[model samples]
Target: MQIVSALSEISDRYDALFVDLWGCVHDGVRVIPGANEALRAFRAKGGKVILVTNSPRPRAGVERQMDAFGVARDAWDDIATSGDSARVAMYRGIVGQKVWHLGYAGEEDGGFFTPPNVLDDPLEIARVPLDVAEGVVCTGPPDPSAHPDVMRPELLLAKTRGLKLLCANPDIVVDRGDRREWCAGAIAKLYSEMGGESLYFGKPHPPIYDLARRRLAKLADVPDAAILAIGDGPLTDAAGAMGEDLDLLFISGGLGAEETGTPRLGDPDPEKLAAYLEATGVVPTFVIGSLR
Candidate 1:
């Protein structure tokens, strides 16, 4: 893997970029220092920027969040979210009709009940109680700060009933500015470990990547070889890129900041970065401390 100082080093190679949002572009609170500039520069040079995210929110919801975070509107051309993909699966009755909603009460989860418009004559899903639920739809835990294993009892009951969990976001955790919180993926991972079946539609999985390609196709006819994937999550973004056979620009400063020993103003320590990459089994084509 080659460690580059900026996106410009390799931006000329790809016609399109599949960029991850949370850790690459923004830290959940604000846009990264060079993210907006780099993306805008890419778009200005006639390159397409598709913000392929594992966010459980639909594109519109992501837009709103981006606006709240002060992210520029011109930074991205389009978005393909895990929420939309999982929403389609949910409406297709992948997890049955009567499902139990497992997420925070007031948070914006795109109403989890709302059906995607792409499907014709979609299934009518209801948020029934867990006792009567045929499946479970998890956006995340009711409490992000709480450990995912805390729901073991509830998951145990659902497992006994043979209920499959439809995981909207396949991210184990995400950083909201400075605070890191557990995500739906963690819960789904735990459920799967307990012998319960958990269905994922996000990164490291093909569903969301398929959705991203369709979204990109709506704008241009770019081939798989002409695309570049950028992100911070080794398991999600890196694994997903490798799975899709795309070149990856892994941001070491996101989840593996300490492990990579990336300083605030320079490239990561080469030895530490190599060790970290070896441990994670992620072979990124390019590595950057941040999107800059």
Candidate 2:
């Protein structure tokens, strides 16, 4: 892979960018130093930047969190969250149908819910028993550390009922603060393995990328070849870029740094990093230690 120290070195090559939020821009707790500035600089040069994220919350909700983190509104042209795509399915008659929700809606977070009327009005699709629900909307486990075994019974029950699942986030794991935690993808994977029909709406999946491209095109008349996808997850970001036929800028120092024999910000071993990317089978156009 061609290694670069700064995004500015290759900024002129693309007219638009699809940037991942969780690992590339922030670690769920704080913004990565220089990451936001890199995007701002890209925007300053007339390139459109779309903050595409696997966050299971709606775009507005994700924006609220970004606002709390002090992310400048002008850093990107627009935002698209996995929840936005999943919500599309909901709005397309899914909400009117009896659906079940599986995830933790923090007491302070209004976008999450569970059975027993945990979801608020306009979002409380259906809270009926599993046998009565028509589909499942999995945001993630109720707890970060929740294992598949903890949710196997429920997923298996859904499978037995032949219910379809709308997975808001296709990420199996995410870096929260200083630790890795399970995500909805893990549960969805298990559900599919057990004969359930699960639909994912995030990176590495076509729907979110399609939505992002539409939004990006509205902001700037850019061709597919002129857009670059930047992220830290090899499986999600790199895989998604390849599937979408877009150039990828892999951030090796984020969540996948361990595969390169180091932690975030530590110097990556070139040979090991190459092997890691090869294993993933998605070669990025460039590799950078950080988005800086």
**TM-score winner among the candidates?**
1
Q: Residue 257 error for model 1, in Å? A: 0.4
Off by more than 4 A, model 2: 94-96, 105-124
Candidate 2 structure quality by residue, lDDT tens digits, 1-292: 6888889999899999999998788888888878878989999989999989988887767888988876778888898778778777665645346878788544354454422221344444555677788888788877769687688888888888878888888898988778899998988888888888889889999989888988987777889999999998877898999889999899888877878764565556898888888887868999887777
Supply the global lDDT for candidate 1: 0.91
lDDT for model 2 comes to: 0.81
* lDDT, model 1, position 148: 96
Residue pairs of candidate 2 with colliding backbone atoms: none
Task: Report residue 38 deviation for candidate 1 (angstroms).
Answer: 0.1
Tens digits of lDDT, candidate 1, 245-282: 99999999998888999975367999999999999999
What residue pairs clash in candidate 1, if any at all?
Answer: none
Model 1 Cα shift for residue 205 (angstroms):
0.4
Q: Assess each prediction's global lDDT (C-alpha) against the native.
A: 0.91, 0.81
- For candidate 1, the per-residue lDDT at 241 reads 99
